[model samples]
Target: MEAFVQSKREDTAKEPSLFLLPEWMEADKRLTAGFTGRGGGVSAEPWTGLNIGLHVGDDEEAVILNRKRVTEALGWPFEAWTCTEQVHGSRVAQVTLAERGKGRERMDDTIAGCDALMTDVPGVLLTSFYADCVPLYFYAPEAGAVALAHAGWRGTVGGIAARTAEAMASAYGVRPDQILAAIGPSIGDCCYEVDGLVVTEVDRVMDELKLPEGERESCMQRKKNGKASLNLKELNRQIMIKAGILPSRIELTTWCTGCRTDLFYSYRVEGGKTGRMASWIGLQER
Candidate 1:
């Protein structure tokens, strides 16, 4: 069974064209977590899809309109929209009520160089833009806390997943076992081939993690061509497990951005200049 349920829109220009994690969101009525799809927006040309990222060259007004549409579709106020300047680093910033709407419209307003956003503030939606990088979601339901991490290869190797969980634990007194984790859509092993430097970093991270031989092999399938097919979502899942999130509690997405560019914006397949989807998690006010 796929974890991230696709909510398809008949019209490409419709709102809320996205994937929802029903396992987490439906189970907890107050929680909302999902990834945006490359449909139902007003961007043109290379970004003809629902480009939710403001940092990309997409028109600011168009991007904001798309974002506003998504919020309305979720029954959330656009003022609750919040985000960070994802630097593909391991830095996790704690968002408060005062920063609830930071970076909703412009780059200058975003929390600088932060790859992860975690918050216990109800109604504050924590969001991060992505183009094939793994999106890690954390929900300490027992503590009423949620987080979103942008795990590009650098953020992954830097251990952003563990850092976000640890931050949640420290800030909200959440036990690792009590956290519900989800891995969102990204480039899967089939289309994410890596060589040289990437392979070295992955090996180093696995060594530090002390993952079993089978697990290590599954994370990186080496080919005779001296390259490896990297399963980033799996690598991040293993990391979440090491961080104390239970295997059964974690929901992994089968949607591959690289293999399914029609549904997702793939930076690898799109020659780097492309739109970005948003992964968001927030606690609603009662």
Candidate 2:
């Protein structure tokens, strides 16, 4: 139930410490997950410092070194890290030991083709990159299973988080109640504005939009103007609740990438010119 926050230091000479969720607080022996803020790593300038997204135009060697730093910070072997190409779709990939190093071989690996990844194998780090889009992490200690998902507005409306949870349950026998979720840093409600298309898609997936007593009309009315402010974090939280996870088990980082330009990357802030931050999870080998 405790939370830890690590701020980035201006100097790189200090040992890079990736944020971590305390094991005692989490009460889960088999799972570990955290979001990597913009600090750490070797990329410079636009992709300066710990930029993990390979396709973001950073030098290949810098990106490789950044990944190595991240893996080392997490106490994971460099070769055990697994990430996919995220297409903002609802597809989820199942990872096994045999599949290790499949996605990291080259930037063009199939990992980018899948938006979500799940695995029960220890030492296999499952990761997804993001800027403003929400990154969802799931862990089922009893089943020794974990998953990472990339949820943009489209994927959110498509119920990607819920689908990933269901997949973990079906594939690994993880009970929804036993699953612990961490909704990582992303664009918060303060900055996320959408159009009618997004609202309609959200309504289609969510049973009813429950607004504050006097805010119902205003909430729906904004959609008609072709632009409406949406709370993506809250929206995804609702999706998790509907999937049967308890509200208490979910932890949300209030840091908004769009708001904190210096600490994290944001597509909204940089306008397609920004690098990406990463959220990663894996089980340590016994």
Would you estimate the TM-scores of all the predictions?
0.97, 0.89
| All-Cα superposition RMSD per candidate | 1.1, 2.9
What overall lDDT, based on C-alpha atoms, would model 1 receive against the true structure? 0.92
Candidate 1 lDDT at 101 equals: 96
**Highest-lDDT candidate:** 1
lDDT of 2 at 197: 78
Model 1 spans > 4 angstroms off: 9-12
- Output the number of the TM-score-best candidate: 1
Model 1 weakest 10-residue run by lDDT: 8-17
What's the residue-level lDDT of 210 in candidate 1? Answer: 98
Off by over 4 Å in 2: 1-4, 7-17, 23-30, 208-225
Candidate 2 Cα RMSD after full superposition onto the native fold (Å): 2.9
Give each model's whole-structure lDDT.
Answer: 0.92, 0.77
lDDT of 1 by residue, 167-258 (tens): 99999999999998999999999989999999999999999889999999989999999999999999999999999999999999999999
When summed lDDT is taken over every stretch of 10 residues in candidate 2, the lowest stretch is 212-221
